[model samples]
Target: MAFGLVRIALECDKEEENKGVRVLLEELVWRTYCNGKKSGFATRRECEPKE
Candidate 1:
């Protein structure tokens, strides 16, 4: 039998000056639930040019 897998990708903006430090920043992400249970949180940010 084959199992199904789910993948998610998030894009964020690259700061002009700082690149490494931006990853540490925390943004409030909305929570998602499935079957009356918490599933995950979703957050969005600016996307980089390469991304």
Candidate 2:
């Protein structure tokens, strides 16, 4: 069996949005871990209109 985990970090600006409430996930960074070891890293990015 294999085990995996992912940790995400979000960025928020504005006190009103941080009142112990949910906020929009505009940007974030994530790290993946497998078998108790770091595996990969990823970040949120905007895609171009023309793919």
Q: What is the TM-score of each candidate against the true structure?
A: 0.32, 0.35
> Candidate 1: misplaced stretches above 4 Å?
1-28
Candidate 1 residue 22 C-alpha distance from true site, Å: 24
lDDT (C-alpha, whole model) for all candidates: 0.56, 0.57
Weakest ten-residue segment in model 2 by summed lDDT: 6-15
**RMSD, each candidate, Å?**
11.5, 6.3
User: What number of clashing residue pairs does each candidate have, in the order they appear?
Assistant: 2, 0
Q: Mind sharing the TM-score for model 1?
A: 0.32
lDDT tens string, model 1, 1-51? 866765444334455774445553464455565545666777757889999
Candidate with the greatest TM-score versus the true structure: 2
